[model samples]
Target chain A: MNAPAQPVLEVRNLSKSLGGKLILDDVSLTLNKGELKVLIGPSGGGKSTLLQCVHYLHRPDRGDVFLEGRSAAEMGRRNICAFRQEIGMIFQDFNLFDHLDAENNVAIALRKVKGLAKAAALARARAELDRVGLADKADLFPAQLSGGQKQRVSIARALAMDPKVMLLDEPTSALDPDLIGEVLNVVADLARGGMTMLMATHQIGFARRLTREIIFMENGRIIETGRPDDLLAPASESRAAAFCAKLTELLGH
Target chain B: MFDLAYYQTLWPRLFSGFWLSLSTIIPAALAGLAIGVVVGTVRGAMFPRFLVAPLNAYVSLFRGTALVVQLFVCYYGLPQLAMWLKPFFAARGLPELWRIFYLSPYAASVLIFALCSGAYHSEYIRGAILSIKKGQFAAARALGFTQAQTFWNIIVPQAARRAWPGCGNEIVYLIKYSSLAYIVTFKELTGTAMTLANSSFRYAETFFAAGLYYLFMTTLAAWIMRRLEKAYAVPGFGRG
Candidate 1:
């Protein structure tokens, strides 16, 4: 086997408190090159906070984010900005700029932050949208697109950044069941293409099929980490096993 | 009595005065709106906490005070302050500072009117900016937009578009209040009407004509505002 590549992302002892309540408690996680790690947890179990904190959106009160062996806090404004360009975040609500059409929404970051000329940035945006199978819908507004299509545009937007790590928070939660497959198929393709992804989701079937690393959380703490069979087997006693069993029963999967 | 005899001479004089009012009011409104955008963004963001209170006080002081009084002080009181500071300015080897005393009355009045208009505009703009969803800020930040970049590139344009209706109302006020330029002896529309009434003893005919003129100007102002709103409105966002 090839020796493991250096860790691409390291969250060291990250703790966050919001509204005087601890939302993240000394959580430490790492993402290696080309690894797909799934975070499965109950609602409000720090999954979203962990993702946001990694991007410095929540600004963890006590921890350092090391991206490619460089601490985020050590960087200046310009450096932190450049550093953020390497990490892409996708939201459940899709958060497309309402004022911009689909193509401009995907192209804005490239033009503004990356300083690409308008034509080049737009061409790249079109290419990414085509990759997500939304080339024809490029002119539609977010309000004009369906939940699934909006999510795909957002995914294409993140892809346009050429990020080294992609952080997705419940990418399928907002979609109708019929639309979930289309978005997941795109994500599954990304994973197969060797994109490093750390995602928080409750899609157990997809988690089982597309990834081997599952981290289950409850009450803002990871209770177990293992492969799907080891953690979700009917005979297992781990909290994760019981949780998945209950989900299966409730969801009738 | 409808004065047909005075129409030729009186109409020409009122037209010249209307030109003066237009020159001052148009620039004042544009400058005020620009200042409003900047101050409103700063006040609404309340970033750099130290400046927030001072900015609030500045806005309040202007919005609360009477514009007539503000104009009185700006026109009459500022000359005294400028006089008192003349030796101080001259001592610094900048005698060109006295050129302020030689400024056109319209320019001086525009300065005060612009600031007063800006205070009102800022309130409208602040409300518009605050009305935008917090998610816009969060999403932009997540996309790696710096605070300055998010504000200038994203927030300002959206807020300006939202502030359009309020700006239209303010501009109507601007057209009528521009007669105040006459108060400071600027010979604007109302001032010309006053001179015509004093000499001809036809206050009813002259002042009534001026009122119709104001109504016409305001109608034109509202029409332009409607066109501006249509031009800048974002598709599929706020139209509903």
Candidate 2:
């Protein structure tokens, strides 16, 4: 009935290497409108590199990425900036500009990239911060906030851009166990709200509860792909199930 | 013997010299800092190596040479070079080009001081810029900020904060080295003191008072720098 809504994001045969090491070999995925997909894999399996390549932070060696049906390779420099603005990225380090307070962190791209007026940008930024439940902490600097709070502020910063899709690269890996839940909660809410997203994370329980599609990668290739019920079942022989089991065993969760 | 009466008589001449020193130091310090920030930002950003290399050479040239030599070249050597190049200019119908090289002593002193201080300040700024984590630049780029916008708005501001103390030290040094202006007959504080001591033969008293003036200036500069560091500091940074 809906005509399949032209896949919101499509990555076809994206390949990359760093320092002569093959980091992503013929990696590919597609995300339809409002759908969330999880990338799970062992360390050095290219999950982070794949997200970066999707964002064009790392140029691919082969193949193409399309956003809303337009190939990123076809875009000029000016168009690339506009294209990047449409995709928000969250880093593992939670890179909120250290000099700015939480509110300015959210408002900066709105003012600089989008050219919003100071008063209007600040108002929108405050609303985003409130959405992340950080309204009272808006005045604080990154160093003054906890790990969870910094990640939330970063999430608010990205949300302020009104990105068409979000790329989160292990947004909670650097956080303490206690701080991880708060950042996960904000992310889970974004998922429920139907913001298209591709996340690289090791939190299997969280992934299982939220998304159906799982992509398992290893040594720069996708080793397995399926729903959590099929791949993550207790007795499944899939690599994804084994990897999730190993992660659970190590984390003792 | 302090010789209070003679020192009193000499006060007016010393005050005028002090005023000249203040005027020279103020403009030179401000110009040097501005140049450093501009040049250092270019060096720190991802500009082509060919472009950044010449600026690096400019820094090395100023830092490697003596300030006295630089002052002499700008004030004295330039006129000689201009005289030699006058024939070349004349062939091009530009006879007045030589006259541009004849800088007033005041101008020459300020030029040398500013350039020398700028070289030092630029090193501090470039180091600070490099010290900032790469993640900041990556984050700005991810937000769709152009390269120039990211450097000016994000990188430069943080680098300026980190480089403040080093730049402040250069100002203190400038206050003391300003005495060198006397070498080219600009007749700043030390020049005035030497003249008074020669006339009255009160060498010890005259020179001692001049020394006190420099000490007062350096101390004042230190206090001002401390206040500025406090004022511009972002809370929760550089803390344990």
Q: Among these predicted structures, which one has the highest lDDT?
A: 2
Q: What is the lDDT of residue A157 in candidate 2?
A: 92
Instruction: Provide per-model DockQ scores.
Output: 0.50, 0.71
Best by DockQ: 2
Stretches off by above 4 angstroms in model 1 are: A1-6, A248-253, B4-9, B79-104
User: What are the per-residue Cα lDDT tens digits for candidate 2 across A1-253?
Assistant: 6666558899999999999999999988899888889999998999999998899887789989999999998888888888888899999999989889999999989999999999999999999999999999988998899999999999999999999999999999999999999999999999999899999999999999999899999999988888988989978889898888898899997
Q: What share of the reference contacts is kept in model 2?
A: 0.58
Off by over 4 Å in 2: A1-6, B91-93
Kindly list the per-residue Cα lDDT of model 2 for residues B1-240, writing each as its tens digit: 889887667667688888888889999999999888878877876679998999999999999988888999999999998899889988899758788889999999999899988888888888889889899988998898988788877887788788888899989999998899999989889988988899989987888888888888889999999888887788655522
State the iRMSD of every prediction, in order shown: 1.6, 1.0
lDDT (C-alpha) at residue A86 in model 2? 88
Q: Model 2: how large is the Cα RMSD against the reference?
A: 2.0
In model 2, state the lDDT of residue A63: 85
Task: Report every candidate's CA lDDT.
Answer: 0.86, 0.89
